[model samples]
Target: MSENGAALLDEVEAFHRRFNVFPLEAAYVAVALWDAHAHLVDAFDSTPRIAFLSPEPGSGKSRALEVMETLVPNRMMAANATANAMFRAVSATETRPTILFDEVDAIFGPLAGGDEQLRAFINAGHRRGASTWRCVGDGSSQTPTEFPSFCAVAMAGLGSLPDTILTRSVIVRMRRRAPNEVIEPWRKRLNEPEGHALRDRLAKWAASVREQVDGAFPEMPEGVSDRPADVWEPLLAVADAAGGHWPARARVACVELVKAAKQSDKASIGIKLLTDLRLIFNGAERMPTAHILVSLNSLDDSPWADIGGKPLDARALAKRLGEYVTADNDPIKARNIKTGDGVVKGYYASDLHDAWTRYCPPLPESPLLPLPPLPRRSDPVDR
Candidate 1:
């Protein structure tokens, strides 16, 4: 590494010291931010995408994005942005700015009707790039202009984004600071020359490394999925170019964080709802709810079990169903299973296709059995 590179590492250490960020976490961020700055040198090329996420609010995601805004290039900060606006800014013909989004979880909430589409766009945008059109307004007619892909994306939000987006992003999992771990005032840097000097120096050093920041990602392990590869590839390239603790650090970060992402999507409860339960439903066609319990309880040993927490029990499973199919209009309902039956019982597959469309991904093959119609009772017949 060059003397300048060594100094850059030192400055990053100082930045962490000044800000009270954990040393290792700060290194990950510093390396990533530097990689991003370097990528900006050829902003026309692919840009890196990152997201700062947490399980709940007040985890310092926004503050971290703010610090990054001061350290990056061609920066744009949006607290709550529409999908169109986000795409336009990233792929603008005249100027493609690196994006920093705060409170982004609200914009992509599960209940928010627009979130799915926006998530899809973001997944594609951070990838090789998103292709969108801008209309040129003219007196006589309008012409459509195609904008290039996004540069880099940094977003802060509650919990993880869709797995697809997560796979493409360098995820920083922030936790709420303990009462004892207080950060210095980043806003007061105006009065602290050292803070300002450090930020400036880091930016300059990052700019110097711009030429070396290519988009070569290391091969992910077999267990690891390809979701975040596009976003993390550039940053890994930057780390390899730096060649020290950084390359190893980058890989470690990816492995650990990727595992976290996988775990985040795993269902916590034991009860199977939607298509997941539907599969078990098909496996034991027409069994009493009691027999179904034996099948689901056995799934603890299956790939679908043991999500974030331990495998959910039968009662927890019922609770999950209650949350989903609670409205009066819904046909499925969860009631206490008679202990005699040895399982919790409820109707199956009332809206299996709908749940699959909304929550689960598309299946690899056709369901094992065609969905059966709900059994209707026959009127009493002469004996």
Candidate 2:
């Protein structure tokens, strides 16, 4: 704990500042700690993905990873890579590789049709000892094989990542540099060596404190708990190890950046369905399955009415709602309603109560301002 400074971290931050224009100072600090953390990832239970995302192109997202490339161990720069190749690369050696995946949106975006295998790999890889079992060899002789997926990954891409991965990431929202804020044009040959020098220094510093950082519990800032806590613990440890301004700075950065991320987070379809169901249920204690479908399909803003040129069917409605579990850990299901004719499937408001409370914020009240008195009618006009 030096009184002077987090010298190495400051240097790393400066290095990033040279090329990329991050939207916030906290992002710069986070990225610097992330660079150092990558070298010591083995000491932690989970490694947070450093995601550089933007809504449009030329936002320097890839350049951010490019600068990061020189500061991490066994850096593997990949774009549009297959799941098999990536998993093989991760398990190639005794040491985990720092994968800097550029253009990752391709794997998750709509045009690519989604790669579930790769998404699963990225998600599982956040935690240590996460392995994917595959059938090796050929034909009848093939045997199940285990592949380790845990590694440090930095991703740069346009658009948002899936919520699962986004939760595991320390997101740095990159944007096009303003005209007045200038940065050095990055040329790998010349600038890379300096970054490598810093990288070497960071690795040495990390090695010295690997034992201390392992299983260390760094106190989190307020409102930081659960998954966010897990994601910041490693980076905070690295900052605490550096001492000086970092410990305080890191906490501030963690709180602010995390606050920003949560505020901007996109609600998942499961949460959305829970909200819509609450609105559709209205005041009734129960509603028939067919009644629910009609209400869901009638919403003009929702896609249910024209799903594949047909209204949402009962099966799809059930499937979508089934994605969530109740507070009692039961899958949400429509119970049977006994009518004059026979038993028919229907949903009970009580069944959805827990889900609505947990998933949706309090429903906003309508202002109901007095309609402006109908504009006084203008005495039926001059005609």
Candidate 3:
């Protein structure tokens, strides 16, 4: 059974390689294991959502999910669906559905409307026995109903996900295929049937060892723990069961990819601001507000340049910095800087030191602490 598992996984990996180009080698392994995990997802206490996200279009994010659609059990690819419709779909089938959610940015983006229920639904769905409580029946006679939320989910989208979803997800930051890269074209008529055949074989292999997988707790590689541990456990278990080079390869991918995620983090705007200021400061004790504004607005790659459609001004920057406090328990605000022209408002290195040390300090070569994000734009920017 173990050897068979390895061979089948190899086939699945090959199938994916032929059609879609994943961002990294680990991404291929992760997605293959994710596909296999979907068949026996009931055995695990939680399901890690896999997100293929890229900054721009034509990055093969959708193609990756499309490949998985053929391989997972009861695969349902949805680009748009209401929370009510989704929870119902989850419970409607006898077999748990493997949701291949494409164009997820459309539903989860900042501009999206009436999606709080859906976000909550996806967040709650991470753990087993999780359910969404809803009212069924007419207004006065409404009965509380539980809709089961646990299911395997793979998402493809244009941008990063909110941290609520990120902590529970295996994020694959995809890149556009370089001109030198080329692969076989995928046609539904020919390729879908091949993928479906592989799915059937994977399902059989999974059924044979469901009990073993259910009881097994695969060991984590050094430095992988907490939510990262939870996310990779089942995939490691699948690798351990396969009894081949896969176990070693799986651990290698786990460590490198987890490390990659930490270095690539862009989740918090506040942290972004802190880190950017650190760069702009460059060992200076203080900078005039005018100089600071020029540096901030000059940053073409970061959001500070065009936050809310205008270059971040002194007042707005001050407001955001106010969210973090110094050791004295007061907002870190700018004080007078003695410039050659006149006295002008500016921030001191002494005042910002506390916020920098607490929020986005310089670090050693290890995993980064998960930084809390700042309040959203719903809070009045002017205030």
Candidate 4:
């Protein structure tokens, strides 16, 4: 590693120690940011953003953001801001703040009825240095104002975010606690001093290498689609500036994060059900209630059967699918479910289609540790 790179890594470690950050967690966070930087260099085809999520609440999303606020010299922004306020905050020349959006999903919601403006804002922010103008006040002839895009954005929420946002984010799916992995309650009174010391060191490091850290970037990686390439290019430059193991680490992080954001599973029964249903519709042209049930039941013999070791029945499938696609608290068609012989049962494909598009888009690349290929059995004679 170059002298500057080595020094930067040293400073990062020192900061981590000063703050009493758990080594593994700290390293992971560093790697995540480094990866974000790497993609900024070459994620031309990708969206340059990150989303942190946990299964349940109080899993440290806010705490993680607090630590990051200290490490990076960027300002925090609420994910719940109105479009105008958000734009103004990012555009302020006084501070080129890194935006942090906590509880983003809550702000957007499942249907995102009132979030169109926010959606547009986020889409624009995907373009580095992109700017837009919005009129202020309710005056008929009010003056308009222009705002620059976010420098960097980090969003945290429970479960998955909305599909549109998730499609463009480097997702960090926080794992629930493992049996052996326990975290003590963070007593701020006890740890504040140590965290503060680390914060000071990180600030110093930020000051010392601001120039190099701001400019250095690697060549874009292979297999990056057009959008990701654009979003991630500048981030990679940041990682390069930091140096040491960051350059390589940045690449790995880019690949992994992208895969998570746009991940797909051809093997999933959920995916198969949708695909199969689509095929059935294509071939049969159209079918009534009885045919739909028979066709769905027939899937058991095919590869698209069962989820989580249990066969997917129509009612359960409808309910699960409802979580993704349906907007109405009570679906219109679900009120009219009927069996193959015209018996009534609450399920419908219209709801399913809606769910499929929003909940499950295309998967990104397969995971690094892909499931092993099927094994071939040896012949008895050969044995």
Candidate 5:
């Protein structure tokens, strides 16, 4: 690594240190470098979106995006913009600006109606050569215009975004700062010059390394694959270009962040349920629904306890599992089995095994530690 490159990375780390970001240090640094190199995204096949998400307010999501706006090239800070406006803004200039979108939940949340066009634009913009066609001019003279949809985008908001957007993003889950954590307060008048100085230095470095970055393919860490790899490729390339501790740090961040995303991805709820069921099954040939519910509820970290505002009851469990099973071929079957007491409905291991292979993430060799034994109920007293 060049002395300049090492120094630049150090500066990037320092810049990130000014904030109380919840992600690991490497993630913050990677994001800093990504903002510096945002202009070169067109040279690559994919440009990953930076998504700062939190379940509730006051998690520093907006503050992080504000910091990014100061350092990225031709930054555009938008509280909200129409899809057409965004498309035109991106296509209007040869040097596309970095888009910092705040309160993204307002634009993409469940109650936000009829934003399909904007959502499509964001999704398509992740890859180069993607465009959205729109009709322009007066009714008599209208023509189809293709708008370029490639640029570095950072979005911050409450709750998770749609799966389509999240899959194309480097997700940073933020949290409120602890009482002991500290960071320098960010004030635009005081910090703008410093941020600008770093931005200029980054531009110079990026200009000198554009060709290398365009062709770069840093080896992905183990367990990173598919869309996650695509989303992280540019950040890893930037790290490789600015060598020192970065390459190692970037890999660690990639693995850890991607793992976190997978665990929290609401789209994977089915997969999670399937995997947990597999663990509950263990080596048993068959298990009753009541037994399965007990095991699931007993799990300390599983979402079963409070899924849909209620514990995982027999009906809910059957309803969820039913989505994976159909009449054609049942992967999970409920059959009446004669037990010591009477005939009862239960699931067979063979049926669940097929579901596990098809729907769940691969499990570790050892099953999750069995749920702690339920507290025994005291015998009723005569009184």
Candidate 6:
């Protein structure tokens, strides 16, 4: 925590605030600090993916990524990269570059037409030394070649990415700026020099403390654990090395952002389904699959109706729900229910209790003691 390092962090935050309106001031600062720490990617065991997601267009998602590209070292912006092109670009650089993929929904969305290889690459790249193998050359001389996938990745798009990617990321939910929220317009002519100056300072500072950052293990905030702790470790380490208010600021960001992600579970279809099912159950002991489907579809706002362009039927419902219930490792289990008509597949209240408790938001607290019953209103009605 040198004076120089602390001052650099402040500059980075100032630079970040100049262009974007982040929902949390800490998130904006964390993002800027991450760009500075991008140079130290190889020093850590896992590199956190920075995901900028918005519900709709015009949310400053792309602009935030653009600002990031200007600050991160050895950065590349690939808005229109094909799967092969993206792989090739990563393989082209021995020292991995900071890769920015704007409008990433096209590659991972439902209409993506099976880019599993690309998806696998991105997922594996979160950890150091992870690679993807592919066949090279003609059929007769084809040989398996390993492409290093480890890199600092930032993706900006509408909605969420797959669960795998999101779990490995520091998720930032973006929104359209309100009229009162003002930011300096980003212009290459005006901002480029300032951004470059900050980038250079960050690189110099990171180099000075590279050894300390490489082995530093900063304590994580309470409630942050496992994958999230892995993702935020490097950022927290950077903050610790930087001194100033960053260490505190970084922890605040970690706890707040992680809690927000857990509460929403926006990127996990299974978790989201579990939460919705909790509402549908309404403390029922058991529910037949048919009834569940009816209830799910009847909800005016649920995605069940549009889950693949058609209402979720019994088969689709079973398929989606099966992942959480049937898996041997899953805590929740869907059980068979015997009825007067016949034996029907369904979920028992006991089975879903664990899932609901773990995945759903806690119910609002009830009053310690029920208030006395209201006096009879018959006289008032007559009046």
lDDT of 5 by residue, 1-383 (tens): 43376578678668767965665655676676678559578668899998888888998998888777777889998778888888988996576878999999998765566488988989999988889899999988999999998888899988778778988998888898888788999988988888888878888888888888886787999979899999988888888888888788888988888887887846466778888888898788888999999999999978899875678998888877877764348645577767999989887777677677866777679956888666556855445
Instruction: List runs of model 1 lying over 4 Å from the truth.
Output: 1-3, 20-48, 92-95, 115-117, 138-140, 188-211, 215-225, 266-383
Q: Identify the candidate with maximal TM-score.
A: 6
| Candidate 2 residue pairs in clash (backbone atoms < 3 Å) | none
Model 5: runs farther than 4 Å from truth?
1-3, 265-267, 276-355, 368-383
Instruction: List TM-scores for all candidates, in order.
Output: 0.63, 0.81, 0.82, 0.61, 0.79, 0.90
Model 2, TM vs. native: 0.81
lDDT of each: 0.57, 0.86, 0.86, 0.56, 0.81, 0.82
Estimate, for each residue in 1-383, the C-alpha lDDT of model 6 and write its tens digit: 53388788888788888898898866876797688779788778989999999889999999898888878888888776766766677786565678899999887767776468778878998888888788889978999988888888999988789889989998889999999999999998889888888888888888888998997789999978899999999999999888888889889988888877786646677877777788888888899988988888888866887887898887776677666642335645456899999898888877777666765678879836888667686635433
Q: Residue 186: error of model 1 in Å?
A: 2.3
Give the runs in model 3 whose Cα sits over 4 Å from its true position: 1-3, 110-114, 280-294, 314-361, 364-383
RMSD of each: 13.1, 4.9, 10.7, 9.2, 6.1, 2.9
Better of 1 and 2 by lDDT: 2
Task: Give a tens-digit lDDT track for model 1, residues 1-383.
Answer: 43365446556555555554532454454444443353343532445456777777877777777666665656688776676676667665456666778887787644444476567666666545467666767866989877665556778888656655665666667778887887677755562455445556655655666656544445653455544564455656665655667666666776666656544532222222454576776643233445555566566545334534455456655555555642334634454444564665554454344454555545668647888666556754445
Where's the lowest-lDDT run of ten residues in candidate 1? Answer: 264-273
Question: Which has the better lDDT: candidate 5, or candidate 6?
Answer: 6
What's the true lDDT of residue 39 in model 6?
Answer: 77
Q: After superposing candidate 6, which stretches have Cα over 4 Å from the reference? A: 1-3, 92-94, 326-336, 361-372, 377-383
**Can you rank all candidates by lDDT, best first?**
2, 3, 6, 5, 1, 4
Error of 6 at 112 (Å): 3.2
Ranking by TM-score: 6, 3, 2, 5, 1, 4
